[model samples]
Each structure stands twice: as C-alpha cells, then as structure tokens.
Target: MIIKKIIIRADASIQVGTGHVMRCLALAQAWQDKGGEVIFILANKSTALENRLLSEGIKVVYLLAETGSYEDANQTVDFAQKFNAQWIVVDGYHFRAKYQKAIKDFGIRLLVFDDYGHAEHYYADLVLNQNIVVNNKDLYRNRETYTQLLLGTQYALLRREFWQWQNWQREINPITRKLLVTFGGSDPDNVTLKVIQALDWLNKDDLETIVVIGGTNPHHEVLQKEVSNSSLAISLQRNVSNMPELMAWADLAIAAGGSTNWELAFMGLPSLVITVADNQKAIATELDTQGIVIHIGWYQQITLEKIGMVVQEFIYDQSKREEMSQKGKKLVNGYGARHVTSKMANMLS
Candidate 1:
C-alpha cells in the first residue's frame, strides 16, 4: 500500500509566533499515528522551531518565496505535487483566499487552519478554526459551497503529549501558589517580563513559578537577566518537551491567548490570559465571558499593576479557579487532533 503524505505550509518566528505551526504539528502528529508522512514548508528562519519538527521525524523545507506572494503558493503546490501528497494543510494569515484557491485549483485537497477569517474567500476543502467564535456562519459566509468549516473549542487541536492528561484530575489549592507562565513560542512583546515583575510585586514567600521561554523567543537573554535578579522563586526553562508535566504541576497559569490555552484547558488548569496578538482578542474575550479564563485584556494596555492585581485576586478565589478548571476540561476533551485526523483520513479514502 502507498503511504499517504500530508504537506503542511506554516511559518513561525519572533514576529508571527508559533501558534500556527504548533497547532499544525498536532495535526501532523495525529497523521503520523495513522502511518502517514508529514512535510512542513516554512518561510520562517527559526532553527529552534525547525529542530523541534525535525526531532519528530517530519521533513522541513524552507521557502525562499516572498511571504504571502503568489510564488509562496506556487512553491507549496510544487512540493505537494512532487511528493504526491494526499492533502495540503495551510495555516497562516499569509495563506489568504487567493492562495487557497491556487492550491485547490491544482486539484489537491487543502486544509486551512485559521483563528479569524483572514481570508476574504475560503476555497479549501476544509477550513478549521479551532477558536471559539461568536458566530461561525458570519465568519465564512463567502466561502465555497464545498468548503466544510470545523469551528469552536470542540475542535481545538492539542499536541500528543496532552492526550494522556485527558482524565487527570487537578487538586486545586485553597490558595494558589504554583504558577506556569508561557507566551507561546515567541513572546514578541516580552509580556513575560511584566508578569515576572508583577509576581515580584506580590512578594509572597511561598510563590513559585516556572516561566517557559520559547525557542523562537528573541528576548531570552533580557528575560534571563530579569529572572536572575528577581527575588521570587522563578525558574526559566527553554524548549520544554514536557509541557504536560509542567501543566499538571502548576496550580494556575498566566499565559498568552494562543493555542497553548487549549492545552492548559485540556489539562484543567485555571489561567489568566493576556492577548498578545490581534486575533487572540476576540477568543480571549469570549473565554472570559464563559469563565474558561480570566482575560486580562491586551498586553500593550495591561499594566504591571493589573497583572499583580489579577494574580492576587485569582490566588484567593478558590471557588472561581475550581469552576474555571472544570469548565476548561469540559470545553476541550483532548481528542480533537485524533478526531480531525480521522476526518482527514475519511476524506482521503
């Protein structure tokens, strides 16, 4: 039997962050489980992120074409044809409507992962937006008739490491102390420093935190210096392969409003979210309204005082944190990646 192959086109860096590629990695892992091959075509120059993919036995190809240009689509389609890939997955704002059409016109099945409706018109066979949108119908009303949308938290794709924690129960502390802080794979704004300073402001003797520094994060040395001088019991970890263990260990989290929130939710960890990107604003707002997370507003507008105050408030609110944890687990079941891969397999069959 011929091995089915999937071509994934996504990029990650300090500017774009790693949400697109990371979520696509979840899908890639799911496909790999089914004995399929995965190839990543990236326009990013992140050696760290590329190494992570390479470690997973996935092929990585750098794209020299101008980002969001017609050549980018051409190169992606060219790779898909060369491999005789069964599916082409495109995830990024740069892979807009015209780009989707170009891939579909080549008669290759296309899967577009989106957070917001960045595409003016979606021409992919499947458009997967794993974020909670207020209205799915309005988001893609101009999509192709054959395009099928997989929207909301139910379809949130989580990495393979999070799968085993689906049934793990968290023992919430009466007063929260342990904290996990991560701003996706690239904290472009260095929002983490604000959080660290805020933690120092708290001045609690028992407070401990594990700050995960992403591989693509350029502000590492600056952050390292800041953490080294801090009085709080904060540890800096980079390129963490055991995120689920950290999630399981933490009593609460202060994270960016990215795909990592879904993993935290799946692990039933209550969190305070800060929107580091424009696309995350709506999702964070919705999650806050649902009590899935405590949305602390945009990173730019958020002050160090505000972060301190929110953490303080959450530390005392045992009932609220417990509720958030339960609601979070219910929102994401950890099988979304497998579910999506099953759908893709069916489509291929």
Candidate 2:
C-alpha cells in the first residue's frame, strides 16, 4: 500500500467556478483509484462541491475563511496534521506565496493548479496549468527549474468519461438547430443571458436551446425565469450529469473560454466562445487563431449584435462549420484525464 494521503484545498461557487473543483475531484478520484487516501479541505461556505464530496464518502474538513487574511492556511495546517497528509494541493487563485510558505515546514509536497500565472509561486513542487498555448517561458521565469511543469490539454485533468466518449461520430451534416450555452458552473458575469439573447435571430420554432447552470449559481433563478418566457424550446438544466451526451448532441456551443472549451473540442462540437476572465484569454485566442472555434471577446466587449452575426455566419456556411468541427475533433481525443492521471501516478512511483 502507498499509504500516502493527499489533501486538496479548493472552493466552488460563482467567484471560484466549478472548473477548479471538478478538475481537482477528477485528480482526487485518480488518487483514490491508485489506493491513496484523498482528503479535501474545502471552505465551510455553501458550494456545489459540498454535497458532491459528502456523497463520494471522501474525508473533508471545512475551513472557515476570513477576507484578506491567512487564517485559512492556519486552519488547513492543523487539519493536514490531524489527517497526516503527505501532499497538499492548492487549487485556489486567491492563495499567495505567504500562505503556501506557512505550510512548507509541515514537510508536505505542494502542488499548485494555476491558469492565471499573474502571481509569483515560490513554494510549489509541481505546477500544472493545462492551457493550450501558454507563455511558459515568461510565466515560469522566477520559479525553480526543479518545478515539474505540466502544460497543454494532454495533461488536462478531465473525468474518465470524456476519454470514453472521445470516439464520437463526426457531425458531417449539421442541422444548426440544437445549441448548448453553458458559461462555467456559476456564471458570475451572466454570460449565458447574453448568449441567449443573441441567439434570438435564429428561428425559434426550429432551435432547441440547452442552458446548463450550476446549483451555486446566483443567477440560476433569473436564467430559468427568462428561459421560460423565451420563444425557443429551452432546456434549463441544473448541474446535469449527462454533459458528454449534451455536448455531443449539440450542433454548436456558446460557452466561456475555460475548461469546457476543451470539453467541447473533445466532443467535436464547434463553438463560439467568450472570455469570462483574463486567464482564459490566451487559450481562447489560441483556439480562435487555430480555426477551431469562433472567439468573441469578453462579455463587456461582445454585444448581442456581434454574437448574432457570428452565429448566423457559422450556421449558414456549411464548409466553414464542418472544417472547424473536424479541426476541433482532431485537436483533442479526450484521453487527457488518463494521460494526466498516469503522469501523476508515475511521479509518485
């Protein structure tokens, strides 16, 4: 038995989003599959992951956090000591070097999951940011050369289901009626509404809109109410389980340039993506430049008119749409989860 206990500290909700929690969960599941004890040190505040963790039967310790303080780190240190965790994985962007340094003396290996490379990371033994085209040379300049850098979607920690569903039928002839609009688990910026309003130009009778919202989404009630009054046949989903099927069935997707961007790419679903945050800009630009997906700037910059125009262009042009779809399928085969997990396991042994 490895007998190594891994502890993950991450948050889930509108501000934090489900992407962080979901990916960490996938990694934790992989760790457990390898016969390692996995513990999640999560925030006490209400999050979508709270119920999910309880259901999974993973040992969890809640950290009562305070704004603008390192109190959470102290709490986590005590919890890790009690659990005898050998590895501590930090997945939140809010954590600074000071927070990481505080737990360094505990003799636990540090793993930092980052996308935004804005802040300096001095304490991480392993750093994983699976962005498609990251400025690795620039971002990792100050970090120690010993830091194991895991970059690109090949190291993307997605669930095993995506890998199983990789061999999807190529959408040779798209109907352009079924559409999926999902902006992370919790759309803090209300990007879903913007996309929904933009799709009004399409024929309502012909289009079927599937809007996936998270349980912790503050705007969930608002989105559902708006969808109820919409002319199109809209399916308002709350934390759906059949995401792979939904993405596979959709003719096109309108989503935030986050983790789901890769998921859509894996499913060969052509997309019109908008940047929900600054960290997502690089991958969004890379995907757009590669001719895989249509890039509309951030929510503030992209208007209803621009979104509608882009959708119309993609919908009417069969050759262009098909070309993009083919490129997307070819880009990622959805073996990312297995690849990432195998790498993590290899690192351990």
Candidate 3:
C-alpha cells in the first residue's frame, strides 16, 4: 500500500527537549524512504522543531501559539483537511485523548506515538511504544476500541545510521578507556553539567569522554564555556548525527534516562543512568532492576559522590560490566524502526 499524504504533529523545545521531534523525524525519514509524501504540523512557538524541519525541507504548517491544548487539534485538523492528509501522527506527551478525538472526524487515520504509559489513550487507531512494561488494556482503557498495539524495543524509533557502522568483537578490556555521555537532545536541567562535574572527580587523563549536546540546548553556551579551558581531552559534539557509530565505539554510556536508554541497549552499551525528567524514571527503574544500568536517581538528587562510586564500580568490576552489556544488548536489537514503520504502513493501507 502506498502512503500518499502523511501529516505528523510533534513538538520540541528547551522545555520539551529533543526526543519528541527526533523520533518523528526518524519516522518521517522512514516513510519518505518508502516513497510516501509527508508534511509536518508543528508548533510555531518553539524554534527547535521548526528549524530542524525546515532544514530537512519538510513542509510544516505551524500553529501560531504554544498552547498544548485540545484546541490545537482543531487548527491541525483544519490544516490536514485542506491538504487532504490521509494519516495524522502525533508524539507529544502532552497530547491527550480529547485532543486526538478532536481530529477524528477529519477522516484522517490517527496514530498516537508514546512511551509513557501514564494516561488512557482512547482516541488512537494505533498506539506505538518500544518499552517492555507497557500494559495496553490499562493504558488505553478502551482496549476493545480497535486500537492496534505496537509494543517492545523491536519498534524503537532509531535512525538508519545506527545500522551502517562496521564493527567486530575486538579484544579490549570492557572496563577500560572509552566513556560516552549523552543527555538527550536538550539537557534542559543541565544534567550534562552535573554529570560532567561528577566525572571531574574521576579525572583520569586516559579516559576518553565524548559529550553529545543538542542544537536547541540552552546550556550549550554554558557547557562550552565550562569545557573551553579544560585540560581534559574531551570531544564536545553538538547536534550529532552519527550516534550509533559513536555508541558502537564506546564501552560505556553515562546518559540521561530517556529513549537513548533503549538506543544504548540496542548496541549493548551498558550505562550509568541519571533521570533528568520525571517521565524517564520508570524505564530507569526497570533497567536498573535488570542490571543493565546503575540508576543514580534524578538529576537534582544525584551527587558527585554517587556518580564517582558508580563509575568506580563499573571500572573495577570487569565481569559485572560485561554482564550488564550483554543483558542490555539482549534487551534491544536494531529492528525497532523497521517493525514500527511496517506496522504503520500496513495500517495506512
């Protein structure tokens, strides 16, 4: 089945961070690869998504204000109606059932993308999440409302580049040298600063640290200022596109608790997790229980002492490190994006 007109509604900003728009971009790329026509209905209030979408040459119908309300659906529905959009996809966490139902009468098939299982999603025709603990009946409430449930990491929204890297199992002590730190696209809480400061105590000259910051990050200037005169050979990367390649090269990841958590798991990259956002706490807890990551709690709660101890534990315990990596890799493979795209395609037809 050919997808002709697909309109995606998602947002990103200093407040919402980069995950929402990034995932939507990944999905849009996948759809475009299959010869589908895609446009975006984006919020105008945030320059983040608008800038990125424009850079990608994707057509965007901007909603003038940033009110994340059910009323926004009316504007999108009107826009979709004019364009004759066949499918409308939404990914924002703030988007509720009422907002989705508002567009249902527009004759566009509704697909809701989410990872947080906090609320009931009764309006969607299809729901997607790559997390392990999602309970469809509980989350959707209207389980019999004909909504297709796409669950598990097999549906993770990862870009194609993560699969292109060529790597072989080389013999390097798993506990040595390389360190990767990524705190989502926009580290709004300055978790990057806290994490990097914690790493200061571990100031090993031999350790190679790579920090990936988002383009819309408000702390980007502050972080650059802090790292400018640093003696450490730290590679500070902004708006990175080659994440999977970077992940493949690293032995460990020190990251915020979010979608990247699953991305790391896909590469078998064990991590030390810090929950920067409230929505991330559940997955952090689950991964922590599985021994894939050592949870250092929320960003504000985590201390230099806690980070130092976890870093030391991962460094000294070789077998434990390997165990975590193996378990994490087993948790997620690279098929997630394909699975979700195929499902959405089938549904569209």
TM-score leader: 1
Compute the lDDT for candidate 3: 0.76
> Quick one: ranking by lDDT, best first?
1, 2, 3
Residue lDDT tens for model 3, 172-195? 275567889899877877888876
RMSD of 3: 2.3
lDDT per model, in order? 0.89, 0.77, 0.76
Off by over 4 Å in 1: none
Residue 161 error, candidate 1, Å = 0.7
Ranked by TM-score, top first: 1, 2, 3
Q: Summing lDDT over every window of 10 consecutive residues in candidate 1, give the lowest-scoring window.
A: 130-139
For candidate 2, write residues 217-237 as lDDT tens digits.
789888888888788788789
For candidate 2, what's the RMSD? 2.2
Estimate the overall C-alpha local distance difference test score of candidate 2.
0.77
Query: What is the per-residue lDDT of model 1 for residues 1-349, given as tens digits with 9 covering 90 to 100?
Result: 7789999999887888888899999999999999999999999678888888999999999898998788999999899999999899998888898898888889999999887788899999998888876364788888999999888777899888888777788999999889999998889888988899888888776888999988888899999999999888999999899999999999999999889889989999999999988888888999999999999999889788899899989888999999999999999988888888898999987
TM-score of each: 0.98, 0.92, 0.91
TM-score (C-alpha) between model 2 and the true structure:
0.92
Rate residue 331 of model 3 by lDDT: 81
Q: For candidate 2, give the lDDT of residue 71.
A: 85
